[model samples]
Target: MIEVENLTKKYGDARGINDVTFTVEKGEVLGFLGPNGAGKTTTMRILTCFMPATSGKAKIAGFDVFEDSLEVRKRIGYLPESVPLYTDMQVPVYLEFVAGLKGVDRRDVKRRVSHVMDDCALNAVSKKYIGELSKGYRQRVGLAQALINDPEVLILDEPTIGLDPRQIIEIRSLIKSLGGRRTVILSTHILPEVSMICQRVVIINEGRLVAVDTPQNLTAQLQRSQQILIRVGGPEKEVLSEVGKINGVSRVSVKENGADNINAYLIELKKDMVDAGKDIPPVIVRKNWSLHEMRPVGMSLEDIFIKLVTEEKIN
Candidate 1:
């Protein structure tokens, strides 16, 4: 479990982060999202005890990050954006070195190194020097080092950055598998990463927390009007006219025309209108039009992220 309250970090005249606060429940995977220069890394650094905040409080597994840095570090595994690695060391050797640094017992060091290497899919390159490995493998090595200690919390900063599509998927899957067993804080600007891997999102902009919620809840909160997409088999003008007359219908426009006289219409309902699902189908039946399909349109995480960030900037 983690808790942060009014965390602020300043760099002279500029603020790294100001009054940012959120929490990650035990075994919860939280996404730390923000655009470039939005203090995402700054926040992570403070939480990891890599740097100190200008003001406020942060705790990891009940230990204050500032006052109990060592205890906090003991319970956390961190993979920073730029992983610090010994390029000349072999993969297994590198991890073994990290295990010692994390204070793993001498007798357990070998086992821990082997276990993490296997977990990270680095056994094939166990003997290969880190510098000789590809970027993807190098990242795996970084992750292995982070896990060598088997910390209760995992703090990952841009874990998938600069990887090819295939590598990214591989890394994403690995991270996803770690959820529910370890409380994870995944920091990245990638929308798909959050949507696919994180259970909740904390959006930061210009060093301030803008939104914190599950993606579905955030989408619902941001939607002012409801949108419904309906496919009707009938004359376009007649179907549109009939649907537009519904009580809450505000606007209707053709979305697509199918081959057999079926057309898809996008209907926008008035704000706070919650009865489109109940109201639309009966209206279509009354008009004698075949209602092929009807579904509510939900905003994508990208849309929500952009909207939240834009609104934060405007305010």
Candidate 2:
């Protein structure tokens, strides 16, 4: 329920974001990823109505972000990278304050605060002042305030930036649970978080949109060749020479295996060489070499991300 078209934001000669365009369908969780100084926070601030774009257009839940700021704000709950909170306010009191600011009815504020506290696992700290809470608890309090309004869309920027592994998992689970009920735009540099939590990803670099696709699709699109790892107990040179002759095999490299007389071979095949995996085993067998193991090495999200960013810089 979000649409952005050629969104551009700039501060004098320095570019914040340029020609940034993407969409988040209703109930879709979109991961917004980029390296430092890549305009991720700039884009999110524009989407959440915290700042206006220099040009282009955006709509949230069908309301124009620039023209209908109030309507857009009412439909979106934002947790910025640095969450703004009243340190002296108690946990529950903070949420109640947020609910009121978001226009929740006075009578329903109590129930709404309670529901968000439970959702964010902040019930135990309900009576504690935000200033006295741990960083993790403060993060949860930030999230609880974001959800206090039960908005149709959630815009979270680095929701798990400083938490421990356990706290990160808890927050990740909470974000996943919100999917299908609220459209979410999660902005973070954490690759695994994008892989585990996002349905699709929008990657930006150097203030430009670099790639946008599901993680699996992006991996497939960016992979230039197929890689297969094979270990064999045989003469290294002979094995490498024979494997190189197989149809569709483009390149091969051999590394010394730890096991005695065993060598590990990394074989690169032509793009879309689906049958090469099956073709190489027989070649080794013809030479009477004992095959130890064979498996494909798929490119991970991190690999694809690095490749995209590096390529963008080169071009």
TM-score of model number 2: 0.98
Q: Give per-model TM-scores.
A: 0.94, 0.98
- Model 2 residue 70 CA deviation (Å) reads 0.6
User: Mind giving the per-residue lDDT tens digits that candidate 2 earns over 1-315?
Assistant: 999999999999999999999999999999999998899999999998989999999999899999999999999999989877899998887788889999999999999998988899897987799999999999999998889999999999999999999999999999999999999999999998998999999999989999999988998887789889989988877887888998899999985565777888899989978567789888888889899889988999999999999989899
**Which stretches of model 1 miss by more than 4 angstroms?**
235-237, 256-262
Q: Write the per-residue lDDT of candidate 1 for residues 173-256, one digit (tens) a residue.
A: 999999989999989988978989999999999999999998778888888788889999999898888888888889999999
Regions of candidate 2 where Cα sits further than 4 Å from its true position:
none
Shift of residue 290 alpha carbon in model 1, Å:
3.6
